[model samples]
Target chain A: MRVLVAEDDRSSRMVTRRLLERLGHEVAVAEDGEEAWLQITSGEVFDVIISDWLMPRLDGHRLCQRIRRRENDHAVSYTYLILLTAMTDREHMLAGFEAGTDDFLSKPVDEAELVARLRVGERIMKLEQSLEAQVGELRTANEKLHADLQAAAMVQDSILPRNLPRDKRVSFGWEYLPCEQLAGDILNVIPINPDLYGVYLLDVSGHGVAAALKSVMISRVLSNDPLGSLLLGETPEESVTSPSRVLALLNERYPIDENSSDVSFFTIVYGLLDARKGTFRYANAGHPPVMVLRNGATELGKVGGPAIGMIDNWKFDEEEIQLDDSTRVYIYSDGIIENPNEEGEQFGYDRLAELIAGLGMCSTSRGATVVAGEARAWNPTEEIDDDVSVLVFGGDE
Target chain B: MSKSYPAIDQERLSAVSGGDREFEKELMEAFLEDAQLRVSQITEALQRQDTEALRSAAHTLKGAARNVGAAAIANVVMKIEEAASENELPGSDLLGEMTGEIARLVDQVRSSGT
Candidate 1:
C-alpha cells in the first residue's frame, strides 16, 4: 500500500517513514498538514494516511474532513485515515470520530497495530465497491422499465375514438382518467349510417401495460361491418344494429380459454341509438346500469348479464327506454361509484345519478367534472385509486 | 564508558532496522541532530523563564526520542515537559542527567562506524 506520513518533528517523521517502508509500503513524508494536503490534491491517491493530530497550517481532524469531502465528490474509492496523537481522552476520541477519522493511534506509533488497522480498511473498501456497483445496475433497469411503460401508453391513446359520432341530432360529452400511466377502459362511438349510432364502453379487470394492450386489441376489432368482431352486420353496408345480436356474437367468439389462466375478462355495456326514430337499443354484460334522466325524475335500468369472457355460452339481455329530446343517457365504469373517501364510504350510485340529474343539459365535460370533483372533495388526503370513464350522449332537438 | 541510561532497548532498534546496520546508523544520526537543537531550545527557555516554550521543546524532544527507540531520553524529557506545563522548573540535577545521556549516545554512534 502507498502511505503518507505527516509530522512536524524531523526525527519522528524519519522514524515513521522508515518503519512503514520496512513493512513493504512505499512511504511519502510531509512536514505538516498543509504539505500533506498539497500532495493529496496533486492527484496522487494514497491508500493510507498516518497524520499527527497537532500540526502547522492544518490539523489532522480538518485534513480528514477535507479528504472525506473529496471522496464524496470524486467517488472512486475510500482513502483510509489514521489519526496519530498523544492526547488519549474519551472526549478527544469522540471528537476524532465526528471529524471523520477512520482509526486512531498514539504518538510514537506501534508498527504492528498500524498494519492490522490498514488490513481492516482494505476489507471495508472492497465491500463498498461491490455495493456501489449493485446500486448502479438497479438504477439502469428501473429507467428502462419506465421508458417502456411510457411508450405503451402512447400506443394505447392513439386507438381511442378520435371524435365522438358527430351529428346535429345529438351532442356528446365524455371524460377519461387513468390512475397510472396506462388504463384498462375502452369506449367507442361508431356511426352505422346517417340515422343509426353505436355506442359502447368496456373495462378490463386491471390497469397497466398488460391490461392496456388487451383494450387496444379489442379497439382494432371494433368495426361496423361483417368483417369486424363487434357490431357485425349481415351485409357489408347493413349492420345488424341490434344490441343483443352484437353481444351474443362477442360472447360466442371470445369465451374464456380455460387452459390459459392469464386471460382477463371484462364488463361492458353496448347500445344503438336511433335519433331519427327516437329509440335506444342496448345490452349490459354485468357492467354498471346506464342512467336515463327524463323530465323531473331520474330512472336507473340494467339489462343484467355476466361479464364477457367470464363464463362460456352465457346469454346477454337487452333493454330499451323511451327517451325524449329533454332526456339524457349516461354510460360509465364502476371506478366512480366505488371510490372510497377517508370515512370508507363509497360515492355510491344514488349520489352519482342525483348529481348528474341536477347538472341538467350541460356539456359532457362540465357534468363529468362535477362528479369527479365531488369525489376529490370527500377526501383531500386520499386520492382516487382506480381509473374512471364517463360518456354522456344526449340533446336531440 | 559507564552505562547510565539503558532504557532504550538496542534489540528493539535492531529489529525495527531489520538487521540493516546502515539504516540503524542513519536513524541514530538524524535523531541526534534533532535532539541537539531541541535541548538548546529547552535550556534557553529555562534561562528566560518561558514556561510555554520550555514545555513545547521538551514535548517535541520526548516524542522524537521515543520514535528512534531512545526510551531513556524520552522518559527524562517527558518529566521536564510535565514540570514546565505545570509552571514548575525541573530539578537542575535531572536536567544535567538528561543532557549528559544525549551527549554520550551521540558520541558513541559518531565514533562507531556501522
Candidate 2:
C-alpha cells in the first residue's frame, strides 16, 4: 500500500516513515499539510494518509475537508485519513471525525494500533473498488438490453400492413401502441385476391417477449401465403374459405397443452371482406365486439365462441355486416376500451363509439387516428398500460 | 533522590526503535536538535509574555519528546502547553524546570551512546 506522512515536525515524520517502510508500505513525506495536498493532487493516488493535526500552513482538519470536497466534486478514489493528535479528549475526536478523519492516533503513534487501523482501511478500499467494477458491468448490460429491444421493436413495426390495397369501394387505416418494448397485439390486412381480402386483429394472453414471440408465429401462419392459408379452401380452385371455417382451423391447431407449464390463449377477430359487394363476414373468438360506424355505432361478432386454446373443437359462429361506402367498420383489442382513467373507470366501448361518430365525414385514416388519440387522452398519464390496437375499414367519405 | 522527572522509558524506546540501532540513533539526534530549538522559542516567548507562541513552541517539543520516549520532558512541556493554551504564560520557575528536564534527557541520550 502507498502511505503519505504529513507532519510539520521532522523527527515525527522520520519516525512514521521508518515504521511504515518497515511494514512493507511505500512511503511519501510532506513537511506540512500544504505539501501533502499538492502530492495528493499530483495524480499519484495514495491508499492512506497519516496527517498531524497541528501544522503551520493548512492544518490537518482543513486538509481533510479539502480532500473530502475533492472526492465528492471530482469522484476521486477514496483516501483513508488518520489524524495524529496529542489531545485525547472526546471533543477533539468528534471534531476530527467531522473533518473527515477515518481514524485517530495519539502524538506518539503505537506501531501495533497503526498497523490494525491500516488493515481496516485496506479492507474498505478493496470493497469500494469491487463495488465500482460491478456497477460498471451492470450499466453495460442494461444498455445492451435496451438496444436489442429497440431493434426487435423495429422488426415488429416493419411487418405491419403498408401500402394497403387500393379499392375504390373501401379503404383501411390502423393504429398500434405497445405499452412495453414487446407486445402480443398484432393486426394485418391480407389481400387474398383482387375481389377478396383477409383481415385479422389478435391479442395473445400476456405481454413481453414470450407473448410477442407467439404473436409473431401466429402472424406468419396467417399472412405468409394468404390464398394458401386456412383463409382459402383446399380445392385447387382457390375458393375463399368462410370466416367460421378459418377460425375452426386455428382452434384445432392451437390448444392449451395440459403438460406445458406455461398454458397460453388468445382472442382474435378474423374476417373476409368482399370489396365489390361491401360485405364483411367475420368470426370473433372471445374478442371485443366489432363496431360498425353507421348512424351511431352498432356492435357485431358477439355471437362467437370462447377464446382460442381454451377448449378443443369449439364451434365458433360467424356474423356478417353489409357496409355502405360511407360506413366504417372497426376491429380492435380490449386494451383500447379497457384502459382506465385517473378515477379507475375504464374507457369503455360507449366512449370509443361516441368519439368515432363525432368524426362525422372524415376519412378512415383520420377516424382511426382520432379514436386512438381519444383512448390515450382519457388516461391521466396519456400512455396506455396495455397494448392498444385498432383497424378501420371502409368510410369512403 | 525521588526526583519529579525521569528522562526516558526504555520499554517505550525499544518499541519505537523496532530493534534498529541506526534508526534509534537517528531519532535521538533529530530530537536533540528539535528540542533545543523548541526550548529556546519557549524562553523567548516567556520573555515577551506571548502565550500563543509559548503554547505552539511547547506543543512542538512535547510531540518530539513523546516520540523519543523522553516522558519527563514531554510531561513538563505538556504542563507549559496547557497553561499557555489558557492564555497564561508559564512562570520563569516552570520554564526552568522544563529546561532542566530537556538537559537531563540530552545527557541520557549521549551517555547511552545513541
lDDT (tens digit, per residue) of candidate 1 on A216-297:
7777656665465566565667555478777776777667776875477778888888878777889988788988887746
The lDDT for every candidate, in the order shown, is 0.79, 0.83
- Against the true structure, candidate 1 reaches a TM-score of 0.82
Candidate 2 runs further than 4 Å off:
A65-76, A85-101, A204-207, A210-214, A224-266, A303-314, A382-384, B1-5
- Give the candidate number with the greatest TM-score: 2
lDDT of 2: 0.83
DockQ of 1: 0.65
Native contacts conserved, per model: 0.69, 0.57
